[model samples]
Target: MEEKKFQPYIPADKVVPEFTVFSVILGALLAVLFGGANAYLGLRVGMTVSASIPAAVISMGVIRFIFKRDSILENNMVQTIGSAGESLAAGAIFTMPALFMWAAEGLCDVPSMVEIGLIALCGGVLGIMMMIPLRSALIVKEHGTLGYPEGKACAEVLMAGEEGGAKASTVFWGLGIAAIYKFVADGLKLFPSEVDYTIDAYKGSGFGVDVLPALAGVGYICGPRISSYMFAGSTIAWFVLMPMIALFGSDLVIYPATMSVAELWADGGTWNLWSKFIRYIGAGALAAGGIISLIKSLPMIVRTFVAAFKDYGKGSAGVLRTEQDISMKVVLVVCLAIAVFMWLFPSIPVSFIGALIVLIFGFFFATVSSRMVGLIGSSNNPVSGMAIATLLIATIILKATGSTGASGMVGAIAIGSVICIIAAIAGDTSQDLKTGFLLGATPKKQQYGELIGVCVSAVAIGAILYLLNAAWGFGSEELGAPQAMMMKMVIEGVMGGEMPWALVFTGVFIAVAIEILGLPVLPVAIGIYLPIHLNAGIMLGGLVRLFVEKRKYASEKEKNDSIQSGILYTSGMIAGEGVVGILLAVFAVLNINTDISGIISLGNIGGLAFFAVLLASIIFFCNKGKKAAKN
Candidate 1:
């Protein structure tokens, strides 16, 4: 067997294109829409928009319709710029929402609007700046090491569009289907939006699954490996954990009594015990898994840091040739000034200290995350590792200051989270820029587009947050502050003399154990964070992939061809599902119940039919391609 050779990196100047008015306008609009949507959803559900594919699709559509003369590279540049908002928003959303939860719970005092805004701005800027140093090592030295499917797809689309080929229709069709399905399922209770079912053998077996037609489609897209990991985690939670809880643990109340399925279980008592034990074990497992993964990736992290430092010392003067020296310097200075402004935004005595901490930690984590993304790709960023780092560091800082009260502790955490988010986004954006560079997009134009996108997205996201808060207050009963709750508990316990040192150490020990077992930690951590149903859906997709792969093909080319088609079809499904789920949620929020169950039943049956058709299509395409190759 031959080892796969990596792709070579193209220079920024050679890959990027000149800036244009149309790119700017389109980029700005996309940034706002994508950023706003991501932020809104992240705040509501703790997840952000998958920007790469959507941005590519929108860019292709706009360019084809409005700027027929524009090259695919130009469109890609615009989309790359626009996607920064979503990339940044994803990071911020993950961390920032905790502030609201903490504040509501009297865990900490809330920062003023100015402080909040400044923190957000600083985080965004810092994330972008931090990625500059790692560009060479991650993007250049490790070219093609990270299979950025979305980025690659965007590049392919641009190449096709530039050649005047109409290959974007597939993307558009996928997006349209996704958006409609998401709207109905998420926005309106069109059908029984959530499906609850349970097994009784385990202590606690009852579990609820969202029959998100679109998200299921997304799982298919993510393919078997990722989907399977997710599903395995879910299975542990629902089938193993839930039932165990009902069997052994005490009776517990959960949302929507009508949705609960305790009665269906043969031994609800056994299920209860299992559920309780699993919850504790899951928490431990999550922390353990994160630490284990981080430890495993430590060598790579160190190498990346060393390389980044060396690159930064070399200076941007002679290295970056994509733009004028003066312009690059000006941008750098402006970014620095913004950072200083962020440090001085609040008059609070400790604000400067907070800012300093954010800057230092932001730099370190940004480098780590960027390199990790370059190594393992964004899907496996070890968010748990970052979160744990934040928790421990923040806890120590708060304890030292004796600011363990709700006000001080929450404020500190909010500050830390914002910084972490900024770091994560910066690294991601940097990687995206590398993709643009590879495809011959202009750096300056992409940068400008990104800024515009940020502004638009920030405004849109702010509005969404305001609307959500006003419409439905944040609480356990509502969009439950699970992540926030976890944060607060850590802070209060660690700093307020209720430290779970034993549990923490236990988690660490488990992490080491798992590492020794040679298992990937991310799946375990994710299993710990998300509910069983989500994981199950992911696993189902993986199973489908496994089955598809199991079928024998005549040749290596034929097998590879079949695999690629399966992946594409599955990717379309996931994208479709997520888009539709969001739309459905929106409808539900508007108090529109369209009796979607009847439609959903049809959809369910249709989904099976759709899967069959997709399978057949892949087989046909593979066979046709194989025959064509032979001729």
Candidate 2:
């Protein structure tokens, strides 16, 4: 294996024009699409698409085609900017919907859309600005510490374009296939659409599954280790935990009419006790995972802070060489001005107060997030940190002011979400900049490109949210997903004077134990938080990879050939499935059922078929690739 040298900074001389253009356009489009989808889905199912690698691929393809003369360094600069939109969108989607739900329920008077827009815009910009100071520390000083696979792939694509290799063709073909699959699944409903499953084992268990080839593909791409852990978590929920619930509880009443054991345990009483129990467990896992990850990364956090201070003292001039290198003082002034604008905008209710709160929290989280990126890399940044921080701060403020009613609660949640989004963006932006620096792309170009992505993303995302709200109301019954439920619980529990301390503690303990056991906390927490069906799908993908690797190949060439084929096939499956999944969710929200219920209702039979198809696809690709290599 060849060792790659690390470069801390990419001087201005190395940047090219096409990289800048492609990155900006791609970033903006992805941000809008992914961000909008996330908001829509989160409100519907409490989950969102992972846009990082997809966005990178799009940027790489567009840049290579348009700027054939550009160097890899130039294309990378574009991707750095382009990738920011998705990060910003993710942040926004994660937190903002709570406000919308709250307002709809009469918890708080709705802030004018203009006010919301401004908060989003400011948060995006603030995230970018805050990341500037930590660029060197995270990207330069600690290069290669984080295994940024997406970043590496993007860089490699740019290099391949320069070298005129077939890789670009493979990526383009992959993208087209993914897009078409999504269209058919989403637009035509070619496959049976099912979101979850129920097993009548022992007593009965209800579980949800996103069963899209895309999600399974994502798991495959994420590789076996992470996938295995997710599967383990799912197994515990379905095989162990649910079965135990079915067997022991005294209140279990079997539902005979449905042919499956639907355990009606306990009085149909206050709170859906069973659902709440599971949620409580998930919440514990989430908190524990986040806190443990944060604690473990504390040293890197300290180092990032120390480096930031030193850089700030030297001024922004030496830190950033891009054309947009405005001094920290200027950046601060611009930020303050934006804050004032956000505050004074008459369309925004409590604009000034809200802007002030957002600014303070944004700055705080930006520092924390940048440090987190330095420590864990962008792919594994503790999003739960932002969520937890927002919840705590907002709860405290609302309680202290005695405005813990629906109105106060919504206002607080909106504020917290805005801050969280900003922080998340800042952390992700810092990571992207690191990639750019190593490839010698100009910082200034990347910054501008990010702004473009933000504009496109914001408008697209806002529209998506509007459509979802207009079509389907934000209640749990209507959405059938846990996002609204989670938000409702957070607001009602803390503001309504009933905190689930026991669950929180359980989650905390679990996170700690897992970390101590030398397991990565994110996958475990996600597995615990997510439904059993989804985890099972992920496990299936991992198993396929495990089998492929286990097979004896004639030589290293054969092994490498097999691995490459697996990557391509798995990538296609994920892309195809994700695109389709999004469309299905959209249709469900629209209440336009394509009625593939028969196919979907195959249950275990359906799962088995999917497993078979995926396995066959991998094997077929491996054989094809081996032949191609021999030729």
Candidate 3:
């Protein structure tokens, strides 16, 4: 945090191997793998975790221990590329799935592989390019001024490269165990992936846990506070809200549901009620949360804008190898070319006006995103709000210009997808640049690494989207795709005005009330949006973190190390489970049989017991290295 008179781990005057073929290839693989994995995770849970730390640990494990290399910059390069995939995946999943969801309802045709790829590529490239001009302004000049917490943590992780094996091994262990666990529970149907219990006495109440590795992993990574907030939100949805709805509207037919509430409860139990009404409230809460964050960030966003233009491109003039960046001229030319291509390209589906909207709004949002993440990390960047805002504006503009109906909706989604990706990728780019600045990595090489990641992930994200859509389909319970659903709702509401306003406004007011009460609105809003079972899984992880952190330790360093190890392990679990989930999706697509496992497997009780073990293992591993650290 002490930025003045700063000295990087690798001094600018000294250079080591970086941007090599080995780094690019390794990083590219991580990018695609994490992209696919996170795409699965996000679509399922309405959230995604950054791949930076996991990529760093894995890079160090392979580069330092396995390959017997000593270059920290090479590891930096690997994460730079690897993490790009995650950021891009985050962007793509948040909005692109709206297209597919709309298609499901017959409002639009399914988006093509080429179309998704083009939008991803253009958005990703623009994000990285936009941040190029702001590197000097945000990362270098305003180092301590903006915490860039994730970036700083990544740097610290890299600086501890000697401990890479233990850390990386924790990740590998989580990955392996989670892969098997996910396969057993979901793939083979050894037990249900989710276990739910309806309280018979409480007519409309139900509770459950997903019992999947990734949800637990997400909970641990987010820690106790945020996780608890999420759980609480889910509680309100499942317990308070659902019961209230049923109690009042038992005989009445809801606006969205064709049947009476009593019929719905009798049919699918409380879940039917949730699917019909609670989700809309959750969506409303989520939109309000996003807008609140954006509103709170407005003054600072303005300052970030003014400060960026004043000091723009100052870092591009350095002759030092580490200080050099992609030439601004080349970046501009390429950005213009991408804009032109998007407008002129047949597969991308953006009209000239849509293209202009993407170009103008994309760059503006990219600028906002880069600096916003510097102030608040990527997790709290209010991207959904940005997407919602863009959709609202773009849809209105399209409607006014005679671009109505399905075609206009498709165009609007295309525009939103690019902007969302750009904003996300830009935030990620800034974070990676910050990491590089601290490590004295060559900005130019890191920029190239980011671009490499974008190119590969761009092509790969489309396939992943297609595969998931083909399997469970978006908006289905198996793959909720929450943010996309919200975007879809907004678009429909605007283009057609058919949104259930009463339910949506209920959620909106709920968010406002929660915000006024001084709680973090977004996490709670997300909890409201998702099912109780999923949030319960995450809550259990949070409780584990609380138990671990609250316990006595031999020393502060030991506690920190143990917590760090738990995080690394959890990151691995999330990725591992996600990869296997995709594999299962393949199975589902092919109609592969898993009845054999069900024949031999235990029922829900076995699942509860295994989940208990899973929880205990997290506590054990969180305390695993404490004695070693002390010794």
Assess every candidate by TM-score. 0.76, 0.76, 0.78
User: Runs in model 3 with CA error above 4 Å?
Assistant: 1-14, 29-72, 82-114, 129-169, 317-393, 423-444, 459-493, 578-596
Q: Write the per-residue lDDT of candidate 2 for residues 113-175, one digit (tens) a residue.
A: 555566567677777776665565455555545433334334444444455545444444444
- Cα-based lDDT for every prediction: 0.54, 0.57, 0.80
For model 1, what is the alpha-carbon lDDT of residue 121? 56
Candidate 2, residue 337: how far the Cα is off, in Å? 7.6
Candidate 2 lDDT score relative to the true structure: 0.57
Report how far off residue 564 is in candidate 3 (Å).
3.7
Q: After superposition, how far is residue 555 of candidate 3 from its true place, in Å?
A: 3.8
Q: Candidate 3, which ten residues in sequence have the lowest lDDT sum?
A: 307-316
Off by over 4 Å in 1: 1-18, 91-111, 137-145, 156-196, 206-344, 347-353, 356-389, 423-427, 437-452, 459-464, 476-482, 485-506, 544-555, 574-595, 598-631
Prediction 1 global C-alpha lDDT: 0.54
Candidate achieving higher lDDT, 1 or 3: 3
